[model samples]
Target: MKLDKYTVGKRYGKALFELAIEKHEADSIYQDLLKLREIFHEVPDLGDILSDVRLEPYEKDEIMKQLVSGFEGTIENFLYVVYNYSRMNDLLLMIDEYERRYDEHKSLLLGTALTAVPLTKEQHQLMEEKAAKLLGYEQANLINLIDPDIVGGVIIEANYKVIDGSIHKQLERIQELLLK
Candidate 1:
Protein backbone atom coordinates (compact mmCIF):
# COMPACT_ATOMS: atom_id res chain seq x y z
CA MET A 1 0.00 0.00 0.00
CA LYS A 2 1.25 3.49 -0.92
CA LEU A 3 1.47 6.15 1.76
CA ASP A 4 1.15 9.90 1.35
CA LYS A 5 4.33 11.95 1.63
CA TYR A 6 3.73 13.23 5.17
CA THR A 7 2.50 9.87 6.38
CA VAL A 8 5.50 8.11 4.88
CA GLY A 9 7.91 10.65 6.35
CA LYS A 10 6.34 10.50 9.79
CA ARG A 11 6.36 6.72 9.76
CA TYR A 12 9.98 6.69 8.69
CA GLY A 13 10.88 9.15 11.44
CA LYS A 14 9.04 7.15 14.10
CA ALA A 15 10.70 3.94 13.00
CA LEU A 16 14.13 5.56 13.03
CA PHE A 17 13.51 7.13 16.42
CA GLU A 18 12.46 3.80 17.90
CA LEU A 19 15.42 1.99 16.43
CA ALA A 20 17.83 4.66 17.59
CA ILE A 21 16.42 4.42 21.10
CA GLU A 22 16.53 0.63 21.14
CA LYS A 23 20.13 0.62 19.95
CA HIS A 24 21.20 3.51 22.17
CA GLU A 25 22.38 5.35 19.08
CA ALA A 26 20.34 8.52 18.98
CA ASP A 27 23.49 10.69 18.79
CA SER A 28 24.92 8.55 16.04
CA ILE A 29 21.72 8.76 14.08
CA TYR A 30 21.66 12.54 14.49
CA GLN A 31 25.23 12.76 13.21
CA ASP A 32 24.28 10.57 10.25
CA LEU A 33 21.38 12.89 9.50
CA LEU A 34 23.76 15.85 9.41
CA LYS A 35 26.09 13.94 7.11
CA LEU A 36 23.17 13.05 4.86
CA ARG A 37 22.18 16.69 4.70
CA GLU A 38 25.67 17.58 3.50
CA ILE A 39 25.55 14.77 0.95
CA PHE A 40 22.18 15.96 -0.36
CA HIS A 41 23.39 19.54 -0.57
CA GLU A 42 26.54 18.54 -2.42
CA VAL A 43 24.64 16.27 -4.85
CA PRO A 44 21.58 18.14 -6.05
CA ASP A 45 20.90 15.48 -8.68
CA LEU A 46 20.27 12.90 -5.96
CA GLY A 47 17.06 14.67 -4.96
CA ASP A 48 15.87 14.72 -8.54
CA ILE A 49 16.58 11.02 -8.89
CA LEU A 50 14.76 10.16 -5.69
CA SER A 51 11.73 12.22 -6.59
CA ASP A 52 11.46 10.63 -10.04
CA VAL A 53 8.48 8.32 -10.27
CA ARG A 54 9.88 6.54 -13.32
CA LEU A 55 12.50 4.66 -11.28
CA GLU A 56 11.71 1.10 -10.27
CA PRO A 57 11.68 0.23 -6.57
CA TYR A 58 14.57 -2.20 -6.94
CA GLU A 59 16.68 0.39 -8.73
CA LYS A 60 15.85 2.95 -6.06
CA ASP A 61 16.72 0.49 -3.32
CA GLU A 62 20.06 -0.20 -4.97
CA ILE A 63 20.82 3.52 -5.15
CA MET A 64 19.89 4.02 -1.49
CA LYS A 65 22.03 1.08 -0.42
CA GLN A 66 25.03 2.55 -2.19
CA LEU A 67 24.34 6.01 -0.81
CA VAL A 68 23.95 4.90 2.80
CA SER A 69 26.38 1.99 2.85
CA GLY A 70 28.67 3.47 5.50
CA PHE A 71 25.99 4.95 7.72
CA GLU A 72 25.35 3.70 11.24
CA GLY A 73 23.12 0.63 11.57
CA THR A 74 20.06 2.57 12.67
CA ILE A 75 20.52 5.08 9.88
CA GLU A 76 20.92 2.32 7.31
CA ASN A 77 17.60 0.75 8.30
CA PHE A 78 15.94 4.19 8.36
CA LEU A 79 17.13 4.94 4.83
CA TYR A 80 15.98 1.53 3.63
CA VAL A 81 12.51 2.11 4.96
CA VAL A 82 12.41 5.61 3.47
CA TYR A 83 13.41 4.39 0.03
CA ASN A 84 11.19 1.30 0.15
CA TYR A 85 8.21 3.51 0.80
CA SER A 86 9.23 5.93 -2.00
CA ARG A 87 9.65 8.70 0.54
CA MET A 88 13.29 9.53 -0.13
CA ASN A 89 12.30 13.04 -1.13
CA ASP A 90 11.30 13.63 2.46
CA LEU A 91 14.51 12.17 3.83
CA LEU A 92 16.03 15.39 5.17
CA LEU A 93 12.78 16.66 6.64
CA MET A 94 12.04 13.38 8.30
CA ILE A 95 15.53 13.22 9.79
CA ASP A 96 15.22 16.77 11.08
CA GLU A 97 11.83 16.06 12.61
CA TYR A 98 13.25 12.92 14.13
CA GLU A 99 16.11 14.85 15.67
CA ARG A 100 13.71 17.43 17.06
CA ARG A 101 11.57 14.70 18.57
CA TYR A 102 14.65 13.08 20.04
CA ASP A 103 15.74 16.33 21.59
CA GLU A 104 12.29 16.85 23.05
CA HIS A 105 12.44 13.36 24.44
CA LYS A 106 15.63 14.44 26.19
CA SER A 107 13.98 17.62 27.50
CA LEU A 108 16.18 20.00 25.55
CA LEU A 109 14.78 23.15 24.00
CA LEU A 110 16.40 24.50 20.85
CA GLY A 111 16.92 28.22 20.58
CA THR A 112 18.76 30.77 18.48
CA ALA A 113 20.38 33.95 19.71
CA LEU A 114 21.72 36.69 17.45
CA THR A 115 24.00 39.50 18.52
CA ALA A 116 26.15 42.13 16.92
CA VAL A 117 29.22 40.70 18.59
CA PRO A 118 30.27 37.34 19.94
CA LEU A 119 29.00 36.81 23.45
CA THR A 120 31.36 36.38 26.35
CA LYS A 121 31.31 33.21 28.44
CA GLU A 122 29.59 35.08 31.27
CA GLN A 123 27.00 36.48 28.87
CA HIS A 124 26.37 33.04 27.47
CA GLN A 125 25.82 31.59 30.91
CA LEU A 126 23.47 34.42 31.81
CA MET A 127 21.58 33.96 28.56
CA GLU A 128 21.21 30.29 29.27
CA GLU A 129 19.85 30.97 32.74
CA LYS A 130 17.36 33.55 31.44
CA ALA A 131 16.34 31.37 28.53
CA ALA A 132 15.85 28.41 30.82
CA LYS A 133 13.66 30.42 33.14
CA LEU A 134 11.65 31.98 30.33
CA LEU A 135 11.21 28.72 28.44
CA GLY A 136 10.55 26.80 31.65
CA TYR A 137 13.00 24.18 30.40
CA GLU A 138 16.02 23.02 32.35
CA GLN A 139 18.20 22.71 29.30
CA ALA A 140 18.59 24.44 25.94
CA ASN A 141 20.65 24.06 22.79
CA LEU A 142 21.31 27.68 21.94
CA ILE A 143 22.79 28.48 18.58
CA ASN A 144 24.48 31.85 18.45
CA LEU A 145 24.95 33.91 15.31
CA ILE A 146 26.60 37.27 14.77
CA ASP A 147 24.60 39.83 12.83
CA PRO A 148 26.53 43.10 12.60
CA ASP A 149 23.50 44.77 11.09
CA ILE A 150 22.01 44.66 14.55
CA VAL A 151 24.55 47.36 15.53
CA GLY A 152 24.16 46.26 19.16
CA GLY A 153 21.99 44.25 21.54
CA VAL A 154 20.65 40.82 20.73
CA ILE A 155 17.73 38.85 19.36
CA ILE A 156 16.51 35.61 20.82
CA GLU A 157 14.35 33.31 18.76
CA ALA A 158 12.58 30.21 19.97
CA ASN A 159 9.42 28.37 19.09
CA TYR A 160 8.61 30.71 16.19
CA LYS A 161 8.79 33.86 18.31
CA VAL A 162 11.50 36.53 18.02
CA ILE A 163 12.54 38.63 20.99
CA ASP A 164 14.28 41.49 19.30
CA GLY A 165 16.40 43.92 21.32
CA SER A 166 18.65 44.90 18.48
CA ILE A 167 20.03 48.39 18.12
CA HIS A 168 19.12 48.35 14.43
CA LYS A 169 15.48 47.83 15.34
CA GLN A 170 15.70 50.45 18.05
CA LEU A 171 17.17 52.94 15.60
CA GLU A 172 14.43 52.19 13.10
CA ARG A 173 11.80 52.73 15.75
CA ILE A 174 13.41 55.97 16.75
CA GLN A 175 13.53 57.11 13.15
CA GLU A 176 9.86 56.29 12.71
CA LEU A 177 8.94 58.19 15.84
CA LEU A 178 10.97 61.21 14.74
CA LEU A 179 9.29 61.19 11.32
CA LYS A 180 5.81 61.30 12.86
Candidate 2:
Protein backbone atom coordinates (compact mmCIF):
# COMPACT_ATOMS: atom_id res chain seq x y z
CA MET A 1 0.00 0.00 0.00
CA LYS A 2 1.12 3.55 -0.68
CA LEU A 3 1.79 5.67 2.37
CA ASP A 4 1.63 9.40 2.84
CA LYS A 5 4.83 11.25 3.67
CA TYR A 6 3.72 11.96 7.24
CA THR A 7 2.92 8.31 7.91
CA VAL A 8 6.19 7.20 6.35
CA GLY A 9 7.98 9.78 8.44
CA LYS A 10 6.45 8.56 11.70
CA ARG A 11 7.13 4.87 11.15
CA TYR A 12 10.67 5.07 9.79
CA GLY A 13 11.61 8.08 11.85
CA LYS A 14 10.47 6.49 15.11
CA ALA A 15 12.38 3.31 14.39
CA LEU A 16 15.57 5.17 13.53
CA PHE A 17 15.27 7.44 16.55
CA GLU A 18 14.78 4.46 18.84
CA LEU A 19 17.82 2.77 17.35
CA ALA A 20 19.95 5.87 17.79
CA ILE A 21 18.89 6.15 21.40
CA GLU A 22 19.66 2.50 22.02
CA LYS A 23 23.13 2.88 20.53
CA HIS A 24 23.69 6.12 22.50
CA GLU A 25 24.40 7.85 19.21
CA ALA A 26 21.35 10.03 18.87
CA ASP A 27 23.44 13.20 18.87
CA SER A 28 25.75 11.96 16.13
CA ILE A 29 22.91 10.64 14.04
CA TYR A 30 21.01 13.92 14.45
CA GLN A 31 24.07 15.88 13.31
CA ASP A 32 24.42 13.65 10.28
CA LEU A 33 20.80 14.11 9.37
CA LEU A 34 21.08 17.90 9.83
CA LYS A 35 23.93 17.99 7.33
CA LEU A 36 22.10 15.63 4.98
CA ARG A 37 18.98 17.78 5.11
CA GLU A 38 21.05 20.87 4.38
CA ILE A 39 22.54 19.23 1.32
CA PHE A 40 19.15 18.02 0.15
CA HIS A 41 17.79 21.53 0.59
CA GLU A 42 20.75 22.96 -1.31
CA VAL A 43 20.27 20.53 -4.22
CA PRO A 44 16.51 20.23 -4.51
CA ASP A 45 16.66 17.59 -7.25
CA LEU A 46 18.75 15.06 -5.30
CA GLY A 47 15.70 13.42 -3.77
CA ASP A 48 13.86 13.47 -7.09
CA ILE A 49 16.69 11.68 -8.83
CA LEU A 50 16.65 8.91 -6.25
CA SER A 51 12.94 8.34 -6.56
CA ASP A 52 12.66 8.92 -10.29
CA VAL A 53 11.31 5.93 -12.19
CA ARG A 54 13.21 6.96 -15.31
CA LEU A 55 16.64 6.43 -13.74
CA GLU A 56 18.39 3.10 -14.33
CA PRO A 57 18.90 1.02 -11.20
CA TYR A 58 22.69 1.10 -11.61
CA GLU A 59 22.68 4.87 -12.09
CA LYS A 60 20.64 5.43 -8.94
CA ASP A 61 22.86 3.01 -7.04
CA GLU A 62 25.97 4.95 -8.11
CA ILE A 63 24.41 8.18 -6.94
CA MET A 64 23.35 6.64 -3.65
CA LYS A 65 26.89 5.36 -3.10
CA GLN A 66 28.32 8.83 -3.58
CA LEU A 67 25.63 10.39 -1.41
CA VAL A 68 26.36 8.03 1.45
CA SER A 69 30.14 8.37 1.11
CA GLY A 70 30.65 10.65 4.12
CA PHE A 71 27.60 9.54 6.06
CA GLU A 72 28.35 6.45 8.09
CA GLY A 73 26.85 4.55 11.00
CA THR A 74 23.08 4.76 11.43
CA ILE A 75 22.55 7.53 8.88
CA GLU A 76 24.32 5.61 6.10
CA ASN A 77 22.23 2.55 6.82
CA PHE A 78 19.14 4.72 6.90
CA LEU A 79 19.83 6.11 3.42
CA TYR A 80 20.17 2.60 1.98
CA VAL A 81 17.08 1.33 3.73
CA VAL A 82 15.06 4.29 2.50
CA TYR A 83 16.25 3.76 -1.08
CA ASN A 84 15.99 -0.03 -0.97
CA TYR A 85 12.40 0.29 0.15
CA SER A 86 11.73 3.07 -2.37
CA ARG A 87 11.09 5.67 0.29
CA MET A 88 13.55 8.26 -0.95
CA ASN A 89 10.87 10.87 -1.50
CA ASP A 90 9.88 10.63 2.16
CA LEU A 91 13.45 11.05 3.44
CA LEU A 92 13.12 14.70 4.44
CA LEU A 93 9.84 14.16 6.22
CA MET A 94 11.37 11.30 8.16
CA ILE A 95 14.34 13.48 9.06
CA ASP A 96 12.01 16.22 10.26
CA GLU A 97 10.12 13.80 12.47
CA TYR A 98 13.41 12.56 13.82
CA GLU A 99 14.39 16.12 14.58
CA ARG A 100 11.19 16.61 16.52
CA ARG A 101 11.90 13.53 18.56
CA TYR A 102 15.44 14.70 19.19
CA ASP A 103 14.25 18.07 20.33
CA GLU A 104 11.82 16.47 22.72
CA HIS A 105 14.56 14.26 24.06
CA LYS A 106 16.79 17.28 24.59
CA SER A 107 14.06 19.38 26.20
CA LEU A 108 14.18 21.94 23.45
CA LEU A 109 11.37 24.01 22.02
CA LEU A 110 11.21 25.48 18.54
CA GLY A 111 9.00 28.42 17.81
CA THR A 112 8.43 31.47 15.68
CA ALA A 113 7.83 35.07 16.65
CA LEU A 114 5.93 37.38 14.34
CA THR A 115 6.58 41.06 14.78
CA ALA A 116 6.21 44.28 12.82
CA VAL A 117 9.95 44.84 12.92
CA PRO A 118 13.05 42.67 13.24
CA LEU A 119 14.21 41.95 16.79
CA THR A 120 17.53 43.16 18.00
CA LYS A 121 19.95 40.54 19.37
CA GLU A 122 19.16 41.62 22.93
CA GLN A 123 15.46 41.36 22.28
CA HIS A 124 15.93 37.96 20.76
CA GLN A 125 17.90 36.70 23.75
CA LEU A 126 15.26 38.05 26.10
CA MET A 127 12.50 36.40 24.12
CA GLU A 128 14.31 33.10 24.04
CA GLU A 129 14.71 33.20 27.81
CA LYS A 130 11.05 34.07 28.31
CA ALA A 131 9.90 31.35 25.94
CA ALA A 132 12.04 28.74 27.65
CA LYS A 133 10.60 29.66 31.02
CA LEU A 134 7.03 29.89 29.80
CA LEU A 135 7.20 26.63 27.84
CA GLY A 136 9.14 24.78 30.56
CA TYR A 137 11.89 23.76 28.20
CA GLU A 138 15.64 23.78 28.74
CA GLN A 139 16.04 25.93 25.67
CA ALA A 140 13.74 27.59 23.18
CA ASN A 141 14.85 28.75 19.76
CA LEU A 142 12.61 31.13 17.90
CA ILE A 143 12.82 32.32 14.33
CA ASN A 144 11.95 35.98 14.26
CA LEU A 145 9.76 36.83 11.30
CA ILE A 146 8.37 40.17 10.21
CA ASP A 147 4.67 40.61 9.69
CA PRO A 148 3.71 44.18 9.06
CA ASP A 149 0.12 43.33 9.75
CA ILE A 150 0.90 42.60 13.37
CA VAL A 151 1.23 46.41 13.71
CA GLY A 152 3.70 46.02 16.60
CA GLY A 153 4.63 43.88 19.60
CA VAL A 154 5.04 40.11 19.16
CA ILE A 155 3.04 36.99 18.41
CA ILE A 156 4.79 33.89 19.63
CA GLU A 157 3.84 30.45 18.37
CA ALA A 158 5.39 27.55 20.22
CA ASN A 159 4.47 23.88 20.03
CA TYR A 160 1.02 24.72 18.69
CA LYS A 161 0.38 27.35 21.34
CA VAL A 162 0.09 31.00 20.46
CA ILE A 163 0.86 33.89 22.76
CA ASP A 164 -0.55 36.83 20.87
CA GLY A 165 0.78 40.04 22.34
CA SER A 166 0.65 41.90 19.05
CA ILE A 167 -1.04 45.26 18.86
CA HIS A 168 -3.36 43.94 16.17
CA LYS A 169 -4.61 41.15 18.41
CA GLN A 170 -5.14 43.51 21.36
CA LEU A 171 -7.12 45.89 19.20
CA GLU A 172 -9.27 43.07 17.91
CA ARG A 173 -9.93 41.92 21.47
CA ILE A 174 -10.97 45.42 22.47
CA GLN A 175 -13.21 45.72 19.43
CA GLU A 176 -14.88 42.42 20.26
CA LEU A 177 -15.54 43.57 23.82
CA LEU A 178 -16.98 46.86 22.58
CA LEU A 179 -19.26 45.04 20.07
CA LYS A 180 -20.54 42.80 22.87
Name the top lDDT candidate: 2
Name model 2 segments beyond 4 Å from true.
none
Candidate 1 lDDT over residue span 17-116, tens digit each: 8878888988878888888988988886785687678988677667777898878566776677666655678887787778777877777778888998
lDDT of 1 at 96: 72
Candidate 2, 1-180: lDDT as tens digits = 887889998999999999999999999999999998998998888988999999999999999999999988788988999999888888898999899999989999999989899999999989988988998998999999999999999999988899999999999999999999
lDDT of 1 at 9: 64
Residue range with the least summed lDDT across 10 consecutive positions in model 2: 85-94
- Candidates in order have lDDT scores of 0.79, 0.92
> Per-candidate TM vs. native?
0.71, 0.93
The prediction achieving the highest TM-score against the true structure is 2
lDDT for 39 in candidate 1 is 92
Give the local distance difference test score of model 1: 0.79
